[model samples]
Each structure stands twice: as structure tokens, then as C-alpha cells.
Target chain A: MKKILLSFFVALAGFAAHAQETTLAPDQNPRYAESRDRYIKAQDQLLVNMNTTVQQTYKAYDWYEAKQERKLQRYNDRRERRLLRAQYGNFYSPYDNNYYSPYRYAPGFRRNGWRRGW
Target chain B: MKSIFLYATAAILLVTTACSRKVTRIDPVDTPDISGKWNNTDSRLTAEELTSQILTEKWIGDYVQAKGKKPVVIVGMVTNKSHEHIEAETFMKDLERSFITSSKIGLVQSGKKREELRAEKADQQTNASVSTMKKFGLENGADFILQGSINSIVDAYKRKKTVTYQVNLELTNIETNEVVWIGEKKIAKNVKN
Candidate 1:
């Protein structure tokens, strides 16, 4: 019985040793295969990101152009209004809600169609 | 005589019309792009982008709030890793201009300019008066170094090609070697040759 128990203990030690040896042993993988695959994945992701970023840049440029155009239009509108006011603003009368040229002054001026000086 | 005068007048008119060239002076700020390449537009846009992003970032605010003054910076090496001979100086100058105009940050002289300055000061010590001589070693030491790279990729097929430029700028603390700020601006162009 003692001999039998001793054999059983020896077998258990051998199995444990085999398990450790196998655990520590290197995998029969190719050179940098796992790391290379991971690297390739990352590269692919970066490329994809770059592609999207480039596209976004185009979109951003277009958006900025449109915004600038809108701003210019607004500026032109304000400028046009200013010019119109400078040109014909004096002709307007808030009291009558009307426009009257000095050459064709309002009814207060004497005669039909006031002279240029008037 | 009459025919000669008429011919002479006509010839002179023809020559004048043919020789006269129209020269227009346009605003440099809103200059038009005639060629599909990196140009002033790109530089200006990049400067604006960097200024807007960098100035408003948390790093500048945190530094200012903590230090009670603007952070001093030195423009370091910015390499161009592109197929074309791209000049980083133009945009870098524009960036410095923005920093100065904004008054949110400070910029110090760098590179060949800095060296030239030191040389001039050394000359000043011997040549100029004691009060007029500029002293060295009292220059503002930059707390941060701004360095970056301009990388590009060209994808060409037949008459169509796409140019992508990535301008990556990073501000690092000179003492601690910790990266304080990083800003990236991407500009792309699609050309048909």
C-alpha cells in the first residue's frame, strides 16, 4: 500500500512538471505575427481616420466659404442701405411718409415743380 | 500723305492695343488662388485655426490662472515631411503674429534669429557705450517649446490626385518634458491634372 501511494505521488509530480513546462513553452507562431496583425489593424484604423478627416476638412472648407459668403452678403446689404440712405435719405419726410426731391420740392415750396436751387 | 497718316494711326492703335497689359493690385489678405497648390491661403487658414484652437484651449487658461501671467514660448523645430518643398516659416510667422496680436500669450525669438541676436549683443558690448550695450543672458527663457511636423500624402491616379496635409503642433513643458498642448489642422486639395 505504501509503494502504491508513493507511485501515485510520483505520477502527480510528473504531471505538474509537464503542465508547467508546457505553460512556459513558446508558441510556434511566426515572427511578430500577432504583433504584426495588431499593427496592421491599427494602421488600417489610422488610414480610415485620415480619410474621414480629409473629407471633413473639405466639408469644413465648404462650410467656411458659405459662411464667408453669407457674411459678405450681409455686409453688402448694409453697405447698399447706407449708400441708398446717403443718396436719397434727404428726400424722405417722416411727417408725410413720402419722398420729395429738392428739385421737385414739397407743396410748401412755391410754384409747380420747384427749381433746382429751391 | 493722308493714307500714310491713316495707316500710321491705325498701326499705332494696333500696337498700343496689343502691347497694353492690365495690371491689377489686389488685396493680399483675400488673394485669389490661381494654382492648386499650398499657398498663402493655406498659411493664413492654418494660422487662424491654430490661433483659435490653441488660444482657447485649457492649457493657456490654466497656465495663466496659475502663474498670473502669460506663458512664454519659443518656436522650435517644425519639420516638413512632405513631397513638396513646403515652407514652415511663413505659417510659423503667421502664428507668431497671431500670438502677438491676441496678447493672450508671449513669444520669444528662436533659431538663427536668436543666434544672430546673441552675436549682435556680443558685438555691442565692445563697440557700443556701457548704457547702450545690450546684455546677454537676460533673455526671456521660454517655459514651453512648440514643435511640430507637417506631413502630407498624395494619392494620384491618372489626371486626378488628392493632397492631404497634416499640421501637428505640440507645446511641451521644457522643464518637466510633459506635453502641455497639441493641436492638429488638416488641409486637403484635390487637383485634376
Candidate 2:
């Protein structure tokens, strides 16, 4: 009887050790669960709205950048056409001893990575 | 007569077009985010985070248990180490307003304001009544100084840039020089050109 009782106690202890309890459970209260579900749905809707907004903003910004790039390209092309004379836009203005270019400083000199010609 | 009429029409057109600016008033609490830089929204959010986190920290409870009174805190320097010129003063002002009104911690005068207070008290010593004049030694010394830094990291590829700001604040005990509490608020912004 003592051996049986000791074996029963040992088996109980082993079972207790191996059978770990879990504390993860959804709220049982109806009010709490309702609020949680509402909060989750609202959060999901907010994320959807945010993603839509971010995508739109990114697209708009990209369009604006493309517009600016096109404007810059047009300006450069116009300047190139104006500069590419018979002398490859190397024509010096008679008013000053400077090339007829909008770029500051001499074409042979580089100032802040800006030069009409090198 | 024709030349005068042409000039008048041109003048009226120019004036009307020049003054065609449309102004729309917005709620200060909720405004549209433009340029995605640090603004009043960020300041308000940081202040809100600070109020909630500081009040719920273990240090507050510990201090209350030890002293039976709320700890006095003085707002100090908050350095802005960002790529953009972010004004930390606005954030500090928001925090100060929250701290004073929260009733969680006793707030004290700090920086130039404290110096000006002292100067006023000195002036009052000679000009004002004894009871009305504020005394210098009677002021509440701060138990902790709240200081922090606004640091940012920006990653740019072509026209899009992601700016991440880490605002770190620490409360240190004046006597022990031990950091009793630390709080951080991270705000990330994705800006595209």
C-alpha cells in the first residue's frame, strides 16, 4: 500500500511538471471583447487609410520630381542649343572678357562642380 | 483715350491677380502634415508620451513611497541633433506646460527664467513690501533634472528620404547623480520629393 501510494505521488509530480499551463486567453468579459474587436477593426481601417495616403503621396512626389527633372532637362537643352554655335559655344562676349554662358566663373575653371566647358 | 484705357485695364488685372491668395484657417490641434519635418504635432505627441510614461514609471512610485511627496522636477536643456533645424524649445515648452498641469510632479523654474526670478526678487527687496517680495532661499530645489536630446538619422535614395528621430530623456537624482528614470520616443517620417 505504501509503495502504491509513493508511485501515485511520483506520477502526479511528473504529470504536473510536464503539463505546463497556458495563460494566453482572450478576454472573457463581453464588454472587454467587444471593445477589443472594435479597436482592432478601427486600427485595421486606419492602417488601410494610411497605406492609401502614403501611396498617393509617394506617387505625387514622384510626379513632381519627374516634372522638375523635365524642366531642368529642357533648360539644359535650350542652353546647349544656344551655346553650340560655330565655335562650340566658345564665343566670348564683347561687353566683358567672359564666355556668353549663365554659369559663373571661367569655363576653363571649375567652381563647385559647375562649369560650362572644361 | 485708348492708351489710358489699356494702361488702366492692365493695372487692374495685375492688382487683382497679385492679391488672389486664398487663406484657409485650420485647427491647430489637427493640421495637415506638409514637408514631413518636425512640427507642432511631433512636439505634442512627445509631450503626451512623456506625461504618460513619466507618471507611470517605477521611480515615481518609489519616490512617493520614500518621501511621501511628489518629486520636484525642472526642465533642462534638450539638444536638437538633427539634419534639419528642429526647434527644441517648442517641445520643451509643451513638456513644461504638461508637467505643471499634470499634478503628478512638482515643477520648478529653470534656466534663464529662474535667473530672472532671482533678479526680480532682488529688485523687490528694495522696492516692494516684505510679505509680497519672494525670497531666494525659500524656492523649491529640484529633486531631478529632466534633460534629453533629439537625434535623427536620414536615409535618402533619389527623391525619397526616411528620417528617424530618437528623442531620449533621462531623469537623474540631484544628490545621487543616479538616473532614476529614462524615456525615449521614436518618430520616423518618410518624405518624398
Candidate 3:
């Protein structure tokens, strides 16, 4: 009877060792797999969010810069015209005006109309 | 006829001289504010304000204590909602330069620059030798972001005017979305014509 009891205890120890050796995969727990997938998705979403935020920030500044450039160009053109007007008497000045003037192209005057005082 | 020719030649010379643009190359530091607009001098002043106010803020100390490392910073958009045309990029560049020169915090590139960096890294993965290639997921993410706005108020009566430019810059904690610091620099110019 003692031999039979000893054999039974040995068999129980062997069974426990086999069970310990056969470890369950982590995915065996549905919650564990679900949590891992959720974490990965969250990380991916975070990256997208960061990318979008920076891009939008840059886009806003780009628009502002372009607008400022256009404004500056307009101001510079206007200022140049004003300075030209101030330097060369008026729009009727020979060097300043591009419009057709009856006095400039009168009957007796040639190319140098201002010089001959036509 | 001789008298008329001489007068006409003199007038032509004067007009030509007046119309020709003469640009003198002077030191940028010595540039004068002739337009009464936002200029490099104002940008320099803004840099001074940033160094004095933003760097010395209590938030820096608090971040250092909590993180035990220098906080990383990234500069974001600076909107120009002003009366005159203001190039915010130049101002932002000045601010970034100030931050870098101070060495109080770490600065990282944002926007297209950052994308370019990532693309280089991605290219390295396939093209570079295994031993020499750089790995991903090692970027130093910014802890704080700085944003600002340039606002101006102009009061003009006839040819006399006072243009006041108020630059408001704020730094915020990226993770917590809490405003860590706010700095303002106001420059006012009075022009009489």
C-alpha cells in the first residue's frame, strides 16, 4: 500500500511539471490581444494627429507670408509710382507720361518736341 | 537753338539722375527705420523680450524639476493680424535663434523640416549599410510648443500717425495642454508728415 501511494504522488508531480511546461500563449487571453491592438491603434492615431497639427500650423504661416508678400509688392509699386511722379513734375511730363499728348505730337514738332518748344 | 539744347540736356541729366536707383550697401546693424514699419530693429527687440521674459519664466524651473532634463521646444505658427504687412517668419526665426543661443532648452524642427528628416531616416533604412543606418523611434519629442500673434493698432489723423505693434507669444505644455508662459513685446512708433 505504501508503494502504491508513493507511485500516485510521483504521477501527480509529473502531471504538474508537464502542465507548467506547456505555457499558454498571451493571445489566449482575448482581453490581452484586444488591449495590445488598441494600444497600437492609439499610437498610430497619435502620430497622425501630430503630423496634421504641424502641417496645419505651417500652412497657416505660409498663407500669411504669401499675403504679406502680395501686400508688400503692391505698396512698393505704389511708392515707386509716387516717387516717379514727384521726381518728374506730373503725368504730362515727357519722360513720365506714356499717353498721347497733342502738344507733343503737334504739326511742326519732330521727335525732339520738348527741345524745339513747339 | 543752342540755349534750348543745353537746357534740355541739363533737364535730361537731372531726370536720369533722379530716376536711377542708388543703393548703398550698409551694415544691417546700422540700418535705419525710414519706413516707420516693422523692421529688423523691432525683431531684435522681440528677441531681447523673448530672452528676458520667456527664458526666465517659472515654468522652466518647474519643468526642470519635474523632468530632470532640459525641456524640448518646437516653434509653431505666428499669425500676423496687423495693420501693416509683417513677415512673421523673420520674427519667428529670430525667436528660434534666441532660444537656441540661450541653450536653456532643446529645440526641434517642426513642419516640413521634420518631415524631411523622417524621410531621410526612412531612406537610410533601405539604402544605408546595416551597421551605419540610423534606427527609428529615437526622436526627441518636444515637450512644449511656442505660438504667437502680431497685432497692431494704428491711430492716424491726417499725416500724423502712431502705429503700435503688440507681439504676444505663448508657450504651452504639449501633453497637458496647459499654458506655461506668456510674453508680450510692444513697439510704438509715431510718424509725422
Residue range B1-193, candidate 1, lDDT tens digits: 9999999999999999999999999877887767567788888888889878888899988888988989999887776776566677777777888889889889988765766788999999899999899888899988898887888777765556677889998999876688999989999998765
lDDT of each residue in B55-159, candidate 2, tens digit only: 787998899899999999977666666656666666666766767787878888766566678899999999999889777689988899887777787776677
- Score chain A of each prediction against the true chain A by TM-score and list the results: 0.29, 0.23, 0.26
Off by over 4 Å in 3: A1-118, B1-21
lDDT of 2 by residue, A2-110 (tens): 9999999999998877663322346544355566678787863433321011111112234455667899999998778676643243355553223544443553466
The true-versus-predicted C-alpha distance at residue B19 of model 2, in Å, is: 3.1
Error of 2 at A72 (Å): 10
Best by TM-score: 2
* Least well predicted 10-residue stretch by lDDT in candidate 3 chain B: B83-92
> Per-residue error at B162 for model 1, in Å?
1.6
The digit string of per-residue lDDT tens for model 3 on B67-118 reads 9988899877676777666666666676677778888888998766777898
Give every collision pair in model 3: none
User: Where does candidate 2 stray beyond 4 Å?
Assistant: A1-118, B1-14
Q: How close is candidate 2 to the true structure, as a TM-score?
A: 0.60
Task: Judge candidate 1 at residue A10 and give its lDDT.
Answer: 100
